[model samples]
Target: MGFLQRLGSAFSAIIAFLVGVITLVSLLLGGNPGLFGDLPQAADLAALLALPAAVLLRLVALVIALGVLIGIANLLLTHAQRLMRGRALSAALLGSFALTLFWYVARAGDTSLLEAVQLPIESSLAALLCLTLVGGAARVIAKRADIWSLLFVLSLLIVLLASLPWAELEPLRAWRDWLLRVPVSAGTRALLLGIALATVVAGVRIALGQDRAYRG
Candidate 1:
């Protein structure tokens, strides 16, 4: 056999062995043993080891959580660096001022000052993001001219119609409700079911030594 094939078989075997060991350990530690309950006094052994096991597990979990948070912060910093570019000092100063304002508003409970300072800033940022998204979507639609682009246009129309005076546009409101309750609801359910089935398949493959995703 080729080296790669031999290596894969060896890896699969090792994974299978680990799966078997984990299954055995889980069964021992009060998992549904059912009719095989009389096999061993393993639960007592698990109870004896539980204190140290819990401490070790908590430490590992804490480290993993901290690592994830640090990774996310690093990613945000990278994006902020790209956005700020040559205005890093100005951006930092502005961010600090905004944070200070937020803290002062929180502690002072003064709505007027916050309303004067925050509303325009928030509105401008929201408008910028919305315009950026719309521009990107428009570009994609212009290039593709597909059914998705048509649907996007239709959705925007529906949103515009829905936002009109509700008393005068009652029919449009009903149309919006029907669109949300029927197609959107069905699509959401289908997506959820697909996710659940995929999760089950992945778990089964991992348990049966057919998946090597964790090896990465």
Candidate 2:
């Protein structure tokens, strides 16, 4: 049994690696007949190469849709059981979900219900978040009276003040725009690049059968 398991794992890893390589190549090189220069069958070759990637993408989308449906069914089932056990919160959640779903279907997919409820809740959460940030900045300055903390608080205040719709705060708005356009943009790009690199590394590890999860 142990030997068979290892063999199966090896087989699975090989298949995964092959599929990953094929998909990557198809996505990168497919549907670009110009890349082949003046080859006689360039268009035909490109189309052939693109076919696998197209099919794979559709399969992925279908799987995601199915997964979402399964998740919703599981959520309802769990909440229904909880409701039966007199869990008020679960009952309320189930009732709300049912009402929202029915409302959506009855209105032929009109999103007025969502706009009425979700928009207000999101706005309230954003207000709370701003308050929380201000409080956290104050605590940080109190705990550590350093230059970095002062700069952080100053930037936070400037941003908050700039958000107000007053003509007098034009200078702060200019500063905010510069901060967002320069430092914030650079930092965001750096973070995204780092994430992309990490993802690539992890993907390579998996494709090479070096990932522990795939070893099982």
List TM-scores for all candidates, in order. Answer: 0.51, 0.81
Overall lDDT per candidate, in order of appearance: 0.71, 0.88
For model 2, residues 56-167, the per-residue Cα lDDT tens digits are: 8899899999999999999999999988888879987888898999999999998898889889999999999988976888898999999988987887788889999999
Model 1 TM-score is 0.51
Stretches of model 2 off by over 4 angstroms after superposition? 162-177, 212-216
Q: Which candidate's TM-score is highest?
A: 2
Q: Write one digit per residue (lDDT tens) for candidate 1, span 118-206.
A: 78889889989988987887887789898988897787678678978869888888888888899878988999999999987877677
lDDT (C-alpha) at residue 109 in model 1: 61
Per-residue lDDT value at 95 in model 1 = 72
List of clashing residue pairs for candidate 1 = none
Model 2 TM-score, all chains together:
0.81
